[model samples]
Target: MHELVSWGRVRLLGEAGVQAGNDATTPAVKITVLGSGYVGLVAAAGFADAGHQVQCIDIDVARVEKLRRGEVPFFEPGLREVMSRAIRGGRLTFGTEINAGHRASEVYFIAVGTPPLADGSADVSAVYAAAKTIREVAEAPAVVGIKSTVPVGTCDAVQAIVDEGARVPLRVASIPEFLKEGTALADFMKPDRIILGVADGEAERVLRDLYRPLQLSSERILVMDRCSSELSKYAANAMLASRISFMNELSRLCDAIGADIHAIRRAVGSDRRIGPQFLYAGPGFGGSCFPKDVSALAYQARQAGVPLEVVEAAGRANEAQRVYVRDRALSMLGGEVAGKVVAVWGVAFKAETDDVRETPALPLIRALVEKGAEVHIHDPEAADNFVRSYGLPVRCFENEYEAATGADLLVVMTEWRHLRNPDFPRLRTLMRTPNLFDARNIWTTFELGKSGFRYLGVGTRST
Candidate 1:
């Protein structure tokens, strides 16, 4: 068993004035990141920006070409700028495959996607394929770090694959990412903690060296066994998801008892143990990480004969929350929305991200359409993505008021910065009916009621 170690203040050879992404003292290392998805692309860009020569590899020819021209395929704050700078500086490159010329990397990061399967277990086939490719192309000894969130024993299985047909010794380490979508660049630059699951000293040393620049103030690297590191990622996401689900469950109670969730959340979050984070009750917890990771953790536990009841309950509650939001909207529309014009503001799961993988707005919009309601939607960044992903009959507009024009009800699903404060007077004039459903609870009931609009918020008294 590898001992869990926490190093304090790593003393590097040249560690003076180490700024994130601009550390000159850190020696540049050649890195080959497999996969160009969210996690992979972010890792590739972050490493290159941190004074490392990075080559991001992906199977998609179109995506690779787009990345070559410095066109990021997704919306992430500050990602395009960082990637552009690295590309211009000749430190970052993109490729479709691993070749003989790309064999000099001392560290190889497998940042492929391990999407959840039907049984709620993660499908690590992409991860295994990346490992196989790295094993085939590794001419010198290299550390293969798994940045993909995976099962507990996935690293061991990958290690076995690398050891099968290896020209040189290859080490497998679990370096699971804990990045959030909107704040990915900042998260990478100043992570709360970096988990390094390594069996050998070489893997740990190389990964530590690569991540040393980011730990200038204090050491935030947590070194542990591979299984523990892999499990930690799932556990962290599960905990956050549980908090949101718990609050959502309470939101229903608040609605029933006419209690304000904002007041309750403030009182509950004031406790030192439960700081204000993920405590707000919204439509539901919908994102790539929380839902999938929670379900995957529960599934893995059940397979091991130890089911995580709390985690399982969190997933069920999330599903229930989506239904509750849809049902509440229907209730507000008098249970018969056959020809009502409903304008939905904010289709993305959260602000600043175009990812609609499991956005809460999806179910609500689908339910509205099924109920014969004409849904018009608007999002600053995610409108196009939402339209492409679901292809619903809803009309998508560039402007929020345009979506709300001639609408009976305006439902605010996402809490984008611009959607927080709207021209209520203009909204009332534009809409056929002055009904507003503040699903995100961004608007105050008193203000909306004073604006001569009927308003309903999550876990707040309806006006």
Candidate 2:
């Protein structure tokens, strides 16, 4: 965790009486969020739930219609319920554009996507478009908060766009989001730190008022410049990704030297300086944030005549880790996977969400299919998304046991809650070869050899 301290124009909340700008006594501010994607929708619903009137805008007409009918396009654990409740309270609404109805909004959040381009730079076209839209539709002096994860100086660039031909004073600020996919709503409602990247005191005050509800129990706000705020999101994600890649590299060393990576991890994480978090050694780190952010940061660094070697290496290590899992599975099967029945237990990168953007399972499954292996997959929530996105030639099973039936090998990818424990006896009876490749190390606690099965786990002694 980054230290919450006062440094170089960065101040903690309440320092120098800054908390007086916004407090519990102030009424909830009207908010309009541009883009109804994961971050946008969650922010809209969370702000509404906090008693603020919020209007979520999107360019996708069909998605807007669905949201208007209380339908969420994606699968987040508690978002639908919160959104539904907010809609019922009349505090949350959805639309395709920022029309006259949203003119009274005091804060506008640009929550659009900043997808990676071919060279790994963030494609902030959506963010720019949202700024132009705000400039055209916004009626009053509103604080334009950026909730999108963008490269450094993006907020400044957006400021230039919004400042042109603007009828009102639209202040652009970087309020980048750090919400995780599985626990986005909780992360939003109780954020670790609310970053306020503002150029002027008015922008800070208005955003502080907008986010005042989340800061009831304690002060969790960090005030800084827009560039630093934009860079902080990428820097945080890159550091976490580097930790995961470092653990993965250690896991491979453990595999080669007949040592337990878990034991080493326990000792390493015991140190107070390195508290245990993001230290789990799995197939590899994957998702929308880590990989993209690391790559984008590296790209941005290179553009500035500097290079982030650690961030670059982290990206390479993740790809190598995925290949390592794939190669290990094939080598265990006597270096031949052709015509073998392989069951993949989990498809999502991690648990509790249906997002599979850069899941390690993608490359592994693709390699399996390319090697002529019959791949069967089962995930509690991500099967449909995996199928629709990859279009891989694999059997999708509704049940984990069903997916394992008649399988020569079972490879566990994501650490879904239910996948942690399984009927070993039933699996032994169902599998043709009874070989279990625990890529996630979720079954390391169980002695599978006693169940008459050959078990192989990452960084664990093969049985």
Candidate 3:
């Protein structure tokens, strides 16, 4: 562990800066990431960790104040340590204001969220909001890059917006960001490849230089037009979703055929092309990305007169998986939900972060209520946000024991750090019924069985 910290810290100094030959085609430059949410904060820290100056700008004064205090507002393993190191080293700086950050930066990356609307289309208002601010502020010569996941032709629309408002000719660039919440810092520090989209020269070179630290010996930079890069973000999520939905559908069959998802995944992923990531069967994939991106893509396609049938199906499957898990939890209690007190731990989707934008827990909680079950919930950091989103109906608990106390069953939705190795004995004592619903299957399923508890897991019976 010490060696890992040392090695990682060494890489933090740009020790392995032997960028691949392909990067020679484009030049390197400085970066400013707008909107210090999940993507911007992690990306800024990663760049700063690699010995680069990054200005992280956001409109939220409270969040900026918290970050200034060395307090990362949410849970992210190792993020605080890395951000602290970078901030102290004078490589990463934060501000609620945008002008000071944008003017000094040679390349601007927009990492704001493109939330889904009530009709399921992406609400690109935030994306446009940032673009408008950048156009009004950017000093001297600069390339305005879109790091937010946007619909096709959004780049063109933003380009016009900037051109109309700018004193100088600011070239609009699209360098879509692809990152998972849990592994965001690592992924940004050492990306699989860097994608840079530009209308003409200079922008590509600037982006390539900004990410030169991660291009070591891989030539992992793909340069494309602005529109293609914008769509690539959605395409990537669509494909990853298909993989999850595929496995989720197969998990149902595995039960019928008496075949196990674990064994089947091993056999399938052995192909090298299939790769082992995202193959694990679980409640479903939910977070700020997959659900919204696919829904936006489907909406984008429909509005463009092109139908994304596969993406639409994948969205439906994801919704079903969430409902399926809750239903299965109820089924474990013999399909009787009335007067049932069900304890649920981990409301934030797939932990290491406190983002509950589209967490499966929302619908699952609703379902529990509709079935007449009194749901008791607990999460590490998202409880407050969850309560604000939907309250009075759900009884939020302070601790896991309190959540499980007098409960007919315990459902583990998110795989939080503390929840991994819980006191099973004490938990059993607290619960009215010791039914363990392991949606994530973090612990040994057989151990759950031997614990003198009724264990219901997502996939096959664990040994």
Give TM-scores for every candidate, taking all chains together and pairing residue i with residue i. 0.94, 0.94, 0.87
Q: What stretches of model 2 exceed 4 Å from their correct place?
A: 1-24
lDDT of 3 by residue, 54-147 (tens): 6788888999999888888766778999999877766677887764534746667788978889888888888888888877886656778888
Q: Please say which candidate is ahead in TM-score: 1 or 3.
A: 1
* Model 1 quality (TM-score): 0.94
Clashing pairs in 1: none
Worst 10 residues of 1 by lDDT: 4-13
Worst 10 residues of 3 by lDDT: 1-10
TM-score of 3: 0.87
User: Which segments of model 3 are wrong by more than 4 Å?
Assistant: 1-30, 99-102, 370-372, 392-399, 421-426, 461-463
- Please give, for residues 276-320, the per-residue lDDT of candidate 2 as tens digits: 888888898888888889999999999999999999999999989
Kindly report which residue stretches of model 1 are placed more than 4 angstroms away from their true locations once superposed: 1-25
Question: How big is the positional error of residue 136 in model 2, measured in Å on the Cα after superposition?
Answer: 1.1
**Model 1 deviation from native, Cα RMSD in Å:** 4.2
lDDT tens digits, residue span 329-361, model 1: 777787779999999999889988988889999
What RMSD does each model have against the real structure?
4.2, 6.2, 7.4
